[model samples]
Target: MTRIALATASADLEARFRAATGGAFLPLPPAPLPSNPAHLFAQLDGAPAPDVVVLDAELAVDHALDLATLLDEQCPQIAVVLVAEHGPDLGLAAMRAGVRDILHPQAEIAEIQSVLDRAALAAQALAHTVAPASSDAPPATGRVISVLSPKGGVGKTTVATNLAVGLARTAPNSTVLVDLDAQFGDVATALDLAPEFTLADVVHGSAARDSMVLKTFLTLHETGLHVICGPPSPAAADTITSEDVSQLLQMLSLEFRYVVVDTAPGLSEHTLAALDRTTDHVLLTSMDVPGVRGLRKELDTLAELGMLTPARHVVVNFADKRGGLSVADVEATIGTKVDLRLPVSPATRVATNKGVPLLQSGGRDPVTKQLRRLVERLTIPETVTAQPDPDSRPPRHGRRRGR
Candidate 1:
């Protein structure tokens, strides 16, 4: 249960807060905020320490901020929210003092409830990250395959969704696809899912620290695949950090048999964090000159960074004889063999528009055939472990290849 303590003088505000929390708050003295977390806890009168402390900043703004800073240092798990007139100057000060959010004095009950919910989540995440490990044994992880491209409109999302669905078919309830594009991901639309929670929601709070809680956040697809879609909007992407991405993937890899990632076109920090945990990479590119050249540069960059995984599958999408590009030409440009070729097909576009993967619909279209082949490459245990080329040097960071 979420514990809340309110320190406000206004009786009207207290009544609204009671309405919002169903009369479940512990009310403290109205004025003169406590000097520290210990003093504040003593005011609880032997009750459990609150998860959230709502301070009325209308009277003693400086004292509220100082108390917030003390709580941040001493009781970091407690999220501090200030009730004050919202302003740019106050907002900056509150943030500096470790305030989770600043609410207006006249907030409605519904708004109060929303802010409390967010504060509780923030508290949970703070506690989890600051907590130490319980065991010394290394965690057992599953295979993580990341599908990426250097340019947009290269069909990486389509490939990623289809691959994840196909894997789920082979191993029900053991696969998850994460749309790490952050800003403009469309995995939810491709799967026709209305997710109650998203990547932004799962990467923090109790969901981030507990595997069972995290599982509840995933949207269940009809194909039996679990999915963590991107943030609800572009602005939400800013709140998710690279460390959050890394931790989220590590937790997921421990539970799922296969964790498939669909990243943005370029290598953002989030993408790099995902790549750090990826065991296999499905490098995709279109048949055009720009796509091919970009793929070459991406390969060089990955190689330099020592992030090129041993089990890499280079895919050429939109392959056509009339496009003035051949598989051999692509191989020559990238200095790597093309492991898969998906021919251009109108049915593929129609399936995407209809929010159904060709593989999920059991279509016999040419794209579906290639998608099945790609799935086989990942599902078969032997295929997942590729023999490293003798000529290439080992990874720079000495990161192990297999689990």
Candidate 2:
């Protein structure tokens, strides 16, 4: 059964909930609580978190909206649903704000039951996937390669765009790139594609309401690499919660062979949620003291969050031995060996200015070669032997930092 936390400003919530769910749900508090994220989190802050939180419309809309965003960021495992006076009217905004279901306050009993059933099913599947299973478990079916940086202005979007185009050379239409920088994202600007529909539109539009409806929302690049740009407006970003990211990544993984994500600086809630479902992490940084050190600290946080088990790669962008720091120095600082080092090239800046990716720009420059090599590294199989091979041993405390 699905453990559901019911919150409302209505006093007769229990009586009405029973009539709606027919005593089927395992409601937390065994009664109604204040319809807010803090109160709900206080009640169920420990192990065995509820699968969903059903918010009633009696509470203030702004408060409920804030709670929905907070709950998704703090407890992504638990989905959120809201009962509104005009459920259908809320539509895209409701889903964009991390609501799995928006039901009319007087919604049908069956409709309520169906919504609860979906939450329960998703929770059960995630539980099975996230349980502390054997470390030797086989690799997952799909790979989510996330490009992140602890500081801004590190060429993260540049690397992400180039890598996607490089991978598309081998995978054709099977490669996709996603821009997760909600506040200030330049993937669309870099690629020079005027996408009338962006990630925010997908999240707030009817297309994102279902996983199977993947079309027109993603702008197709000339290299056959699909692109999912960030929100056109900063205000639209507030509506996209972490859970929405998880669902989008899951669906994208199903549709594409390679799901390349370019995230904002540092670990935002949306990035962390995507990391949980990711298979490969491309941590990007510049060859500067603050930039590399900040990435090192972010690595520690990811370790504490049990994110080191996946394939982790450190990419040092704008490398110049004569400038600031060398490749070896970067590796020593980040505590992880540099997997790819991109040289500072004027071609990269020109490509970005012209709305074209480095690889697709068709320049036989050093940056283009490195971009191809990056994809080649990703294509290699990660096979392990039963015994240690000193010659090719993996990085120490790098793959499984927390363990």
lDDT winner among the candidates?
Answer: 1
**Which ten-residue region of model 1 has the weakest summed lDDT?**
394-403
Taking every candidate in turn, the Cα RMSD to the unseen true structure, in Å, is 13.3, 12.1
TM-score of each: 0.66, 0.61
Cα shift from native, residue 172, model 1 (Å): 0.5
Residues 267-343, candidate 1: write the lDDT tens digits: 88898888999999999999999999999888877876778878989899999989998899998898788888999
Q: After superposition, how far is residue 308 of candidate 1 from its true place, in Å?
A: 0.8
lDDT of each: 0.87, 0.73
Error of 1 at 232 (Å): 1.9
Each model's total of backbone clashes: 0, 0
Runs off by more than 4 Å, candidate 2: 1-140, 382-403
